[model samples]
Target chain A: MNLSRTKIGAILAAPTVVYMVIFFVVPSLILFSYSFWSSESYRVVPDFVFTNYLDSLHSAVFWKVTINAVRIGLTTAAISLVLAVPVGYYLVYVSRSQTMLYLILITWFSSYLVRIYAWRTLLGTNGVLNAVLLQLGIVDHPVDAFLFSSFAVTITLVHIYLPFCILLVTSSLSEIKPDLIDAARDLGTSSLGAFFRVIAPNAANGLAGAFMLTFILVAGDYVTPQMLGGSSGQTTGLLIADQFRKTGNWPLGAAQAFVMFVISIALYFILVSLGRATGLIVKRRTINPKGI
Target chain B: MRKIWSTEDILQLHLSRRVFLGGATALAGGVALGPFLPGSAHAAGGDLQIMAWEGWELSDELADWRTKNGVNVEVSAIGNQDDVTSKFSSGNPPPFDAAEYNQGYSDLYIDVLKITKPLDKAKIPNYSKENLFDVFYDKPTWYRDGKLHGVPYAWGLNALVYAPDKVEKPASYTDLLKPEFKGKIAIVDDTLATWPLAATLAGFGSKFPHLTKDEMASTFENLVKYRDQARVISLTYGDAVSLMVSGEVVAVLIGWTGIPVETAKQGLKTEYTIPKEGATTWCDAWFMPPSVDNEETSYKFINEAISPEIQAKVVTRNAAGVVSSKAVELLPPETKALFDYSDVNGIFKAAPLLGIPPLKSAEHATYADWVAAWNEFKAG
Candidate 1:
């Protein structure tokens, strides 16, 4: 049985493993190697130097923007998840809303570029929102004070990522035995208290997954911020883009990317640990010791 | 009202689901490997491919040739010079034979790859002594040493394309860069072509014969001041058109051939203006590939492209990209009058900014330094 299980796992995993080695691992290694190389105006010269790492770390602009990116990431993740949980719940639960739920899922089908372009049109100075407002006499001229600001960037990012958060939470909610939450109230815990003590813990794993999914999507995005961000709102992604295109500084771009990678990995582990401590992932060996 | 966690709370979901965890891990692994494999074998004598901006945007002649030659040619229309320069310099194996470039960018490639093969004077026989303007035909922009490095492919002016609403006087570059237009302006990003005109505006061009380093320094300073007042620095004609249509920018520094004519039908309030300092004029060449060895086919491609009939069709169908003298005769009597086909007489004579061609290498380095410095200055 053990041998059969091992064989099954390897057979299932071989394609992904081989695909990754060729596409991902090899390229990342090349980038890492180049990060240590010296870059001229447009060409890379292979001389070993730690200066790239030092330069990447030393820039206050780099660090400030990184922190701002993190702040935006957290705020976007939290707000998207917070809103998605209920909207998904209502669709999945009260709407008994399988049809609406399926319709909402259709949002995930639209291509990302179309969605970004649509959002840009809606939120731009002359976009659908401001255009309507002006026609309604709600405001006189176009209100650019809101468009292309960080608020607009974050709000648009949240709107884009909300569907992912809701889907993750609802799928995890689907797994819970509703009987346990009913029993807690059946034992005379108040409805709200039972939700807190019993049901919330049961669905913790889904929330963790939702957070991770939404967080990762917002972090690496280059388009929404690029189109929407005016002078004040440029991100590290834009800087990396300039390095490769405008400045032709690939080594520096690589080093800066590696820095982002380390931060993302660190954040990932922190979230994983916090999830475990909170029983977001209750050591599930007890729940499915043999079946899984 | 709700007793259960209600499928709605992200704060109450599980982690480490089987399929999603697996998908995330797999996706991350796939994205890490980049597009090109930097192996030794792939690097050697690789087919020199270019990604030009307007293979699709321009006329069908490029594709027509591919059919005739029976040699496979792959082309993608990346409609902007930023995309062109980025792709070429990006160290990617871009997919094309040659790209259409302006005088502004021909030097960038020369600086980077030096990958040009001189146009064989014998092969491109239509390249007569009398075809182009005297200054260029006597010594074309791409003419170096004794060999011609590029064929004259296209030419245009960086004249002002202004909205009649924005400017009462559209006759000078200095008038456009005023305080009232702080955030409502557009200009070309090329420093070499624009700076000599700025030097002329600052009266440095007149004093250059008795050239003083301090005078050149002041000219540079005045140009930097001009640079600061403009809001948008566009890299392509398409970008200029977009900004103009969006009403985001009022006046565009456009090549005369592209705007006030090529795109006026699109309902943009457009007029091409010659600055009081004259047009910052330029020319482009059909630069040859050092690695390209199909000499007979290459010559055929050049001669056929610049034939009188084809050149005339190009003036109507495409902008004035085809370089041939006979293109003038083919235009309607009235339309032809609008353009001066005398290469030197048309633009080169009308507004001559007589200034030094600062050493290309020194200019490239100094401008690059200035750009970086300007970015920092602007950020503040």
Candidate 2:
């Protein structure tokens, strides 16, 4: 008639565990297995082979797009997090009303493609920005660099993912009590000093998680880059998708995907370590039950 | 110490567990059997299901036919031929009675995948040489191994489109490489349509649909030169139109005739021409899959697809060419001006509908190779 805490926890987690095992875990394992297989005439053959991986590694196009993806991902994540922090701080500590947060969330109701096209309209050669610049006589000719470049892709990605980053940042910042900031301020610390020494270190893990999540989404997005990145906008995600959709080479696509996955994992660890090295992430030590 | 439960409590617990287990089993069973259900199959009973291009549905055109036959039709629109191929090759394909494939994909669907069934000419009376243009008759892409595999419906050309106000009409694909047109041109990212045009530019036009690996590499190398002139690579025909309409690019390499019409709507006048180096053409056809449940209804649908009334509407709506000779008379002035119906054979000779690269070949580059090369070119 009574259950232990562990037993109750297991019972509560059973449905999610079963669902994930069936959907995510099983499919991921299958996809991993497929990376070692081979394809001929658009048909996948079950066999252990390193050709797909080796070929991708040796491919110039693969390396080119992978680097492009990383650049776009990192730049977009950094900008989104930077912009999100201020808004998140204002909402969590300074603001009383939830209207600002709701307005930020409302932007997501518009379609993703619509937002990308909206950026295109604002950044095009004859777009509003160019028209304003032309009217002001900023330059004689319209600038063609605004749209269909890595700049356009990054700007659009920042707009799309900023609200998501803000939500994460707000949630992280809320956990650090206002008393900590007031305490730091009372101890001769400025507002900026409190943010760096008291706030950032405490929310380091959540902030890193927010950054990495945004990075992964941006890197793996094929549609936005295809729409706005122009000739140089092609990324590993688009290349991998092309393998599956156009070439019908599942093994090659799977191999490229795993390579990107490994890169993302490595980047996450590197980011966390960098935070620690910069002293932005303070390490917590576990205490012994008895004196050592 | 164990707590004792009342008889009612035990019964309630047992009943709740049974109900949970029963619900879980039912959910799992439904998930497993969902695809094979009547409506899920898409072509249940006498209903006809087709996978086709976005505007190829001809819903309004075929409304009377549906009412007369008392048959319901369903169509799934696709963005590209790969959408259909991927579905059929996914191991558990949708139960589509009919599907459309471009000329380049006929060999793929019919020969490699073996997913198509030959048509009975007797069932489709509208799809005859007398009704349709003779230029579409007896092609190896549609008729293979002495059997009719596809019924040709709509056709179009992928050629050079330029703004008449900004630049003179290009006489050759190489004209795009001129210094004056630099940074004012774009190539649509459609490999199937662009590859043959690349071959034309590379001086291997005659050897297209059968390019050697060296020739394929040369073709892409030539395309990369055009990339230098291109300010951006448009992802779709709409993107290309947007570029021209916004004055971002004065010209587009390997653009569709429909681009000018689309741009015209936006108050931009553009023109498309088959240059001296020639253009690549596309012809879409309808074929019944081997899994067709209602062959008679499928045949009727395909028949109506190529009929004069339906063809005229679809061609005008899509800004594409019609297969039926009778449809030409029904076409509006703007739509009729898109192609030279009086010289249909000449147009075919100039920009013939070419097959895609072979799937597997010992002496030539395969479709996979072309895709890889195309990606490399795009990445630049």
Instruction: List A-chain TM-scores for all predictions.
Output: 0.82, 0.95
**Residue pairs in steric clash, candidate 2?**
none
Give the best candidate by DockQ: 2
Docking class of 2: medium
| Worst-scoring 10-residue span by lDDT in model 2 chain A | A283-292
For candidate 1, write residues B248-324 as lDDT tens digits.
56786544556555456677667676777766665655655555544455555555556666666655654443356
lDDT at position A253, candidate 2? 96
lDDT of 1 by residue, A159-183 (tens): 7888778788888777766687778
Q: How would the docking of model 1 be graded?
A: incorrect
Per-residue alpha-carbon lDDT of model 2 for A1-292, expressed as tens digits? 8999889999999999999999999999999999999998778999999999999999999999999999999999999999999998999999945999999999999999899889999999989999999999997888989998888999999999999999999999988999999999999999999999999988988899999999999999878987888876999998898888787899999999999999999999999899899988777566675654
Q: Model 2, stretches more than 4 Å misplaced?
A: A284-292, B1-47, B70-72
What are the TM-scores, per candidate, against the unseen true structure?
0.74, 0.90
